[model samples]
Target: MDADLLKTFLAVIRQGSFVGAAEQVGRTQSAVSQQIQRLEGLVGGPLLVRTSRAIRLTVAGERFVEYAQRLVDLADEAKRAVHGLAVQRTLRVGIVEDLAGFALAEILRRLHDEAPSLQLEIHSASTRELLPLLGFRYDVVIGMKPLASRGGVELSRLSLCWLGEWQGGPVPLALHPDGCGMRQAAIQALDAAGIDWRAAIVADGILPNIAIVRAGLAVTVLADALCPADLPRSQGLPALQPLSLRLFAHEEADRQATETLGRIISETLGAAVC
Candidate 1:
């Protein structure tokens, strides 16, 4: 089987649409469709069910997911065994939006400084979305969550703070779209305190949220390390619980390789908290 075709199949599963998968894999949408068709033809059955709203794996695809990962992992390991850590390999990483925006550059820089031939493919989403992508789609994830049942190394405790100018009307909020842990935390805290608030802006990624807060259009929750020094931390808003920055590795990921990457990421981001 063509490894590229398998990669395309996995991308479609993770991305949920031909368009999204194409963007991720650097192919045209029609090319992605053709690749999927080729893969299905080779497999002798349909692998995915395309709905109007979302894509789902067929039973075959569901069963194939694990095998696909093993094949990819084995290929990566074989190459690295011959060429060492400096071998060119792509590391699939998922990170919550805030950490991606705030510290991803430094982390990547450190990784490259240590291992120049390593390449990274990063997916930035909320913790809700990122967690599910682990073990199958992504090799590792950095999230803001308590170090509870899920085993991961806690990099630091980030103080959650509100950033914006004081407003007279219903507290204007700039937040991520639904399912973000940070957005949920802010909303829950406001609701518990009986404070009226409205989402003045909803941003899918980190920069736009920060821009909204900087423009004074709305208040947004951010980690103290993430908040710009120029932005004033708003008072009179409900207090927010701190977030634990953690690094979670996929069960099937190359542990030795990922541990090295994780340590680099932690060291880079943890210094900000210090």
Candidate 2:
């Protein structure tokens, strides 16, 4: 009857195994198993029948799951009733591709540890895509502050800086795929300085960009605090001015996921770079 027990059981059912349930709940497998055992003891019945590779819900357990899910959901609803969280379920979040490395890892880790219920649909795109989506498509998104959104949104300031590979070779440049905000910015800086640049000979998601810098392929922009320390970097011909990234954060009415996601992002990213 304990709400936490039912929550644990439900997590196990959703994930199909203790290991997955543990990861989902941010607990060890043994800890998850103990919770199930406690639930069985409380209910005076076994909830699962286990074989070598499979664990099936017992008849009573199967019947119990429906009510358990409802009960846990009701508890969540009750929490929302008095103190509601973000309302969106399938929260589509947009992140700049460059932040995916150091910035995003901290964000996701904190989110996983804190907000376990928010099923995040994270999309990486350039500022071009994320800006409009924040206004119309996604529930809550992260992006650069759009010029036109001034009246409608608020922003958190972040410092962005340009970096380059230090190798004696041609100015190696790392860029997000076409249509990315960082790519446009880097191009602008290069054009202004009249420094010829080349595409990222190696490119991929946020993490790969960091790897590229470490590998001496090219330089990419990142939050000043979050820049990788191991890379051989230079400011190049004329020093590229540091950029202050204004993270546009929107709170949506449809999804409660935002509160949790925000919590995770704040905890993880807030401390990571600095």
Please report the candidate that would top lDDT against the real structure: 1
lDDT digits (tens) for residues 1-274 of candidate 1: 7788889998998888999999999999999999999989998999999999999999999998888878877887887788874556777888887777777788788888887776778898877788887888899888887424356887777778889986655789998888666787799889999989998899887789888888878899888787668887888988887777888887777676688787886677565553
RMSD of each: 21.0, 15.5
lDDT of 1: 0.82
Name the lDDT value of residue 249 in candidate 1.
85
Clashing pairs in 2: 86-255, 86-256, 87-254, 87-255, 87-256, 88-254, 88-255, 88-256, 160-243
| Cα lDDT tens digits for candidate 2, 43-149 | 88999987889789999998898899899888888888765345324566777655564577767767766666556777776566676777466666665532334
What are the lDDT figures for the candidates, one per model? 0.82, 0.66
Question: lDDT of model 1 at residue 152?
Answer: 82
Best by TM-score: 1
Candidate 1 clashing pairs, residues 3+ apart or interchain: none
C-alpha lDDT of candidate 2 relative to the true structure: 0.66
> What TM-score, computed on C-alpha atoms, does each candidate reach?
0.62, 0.49
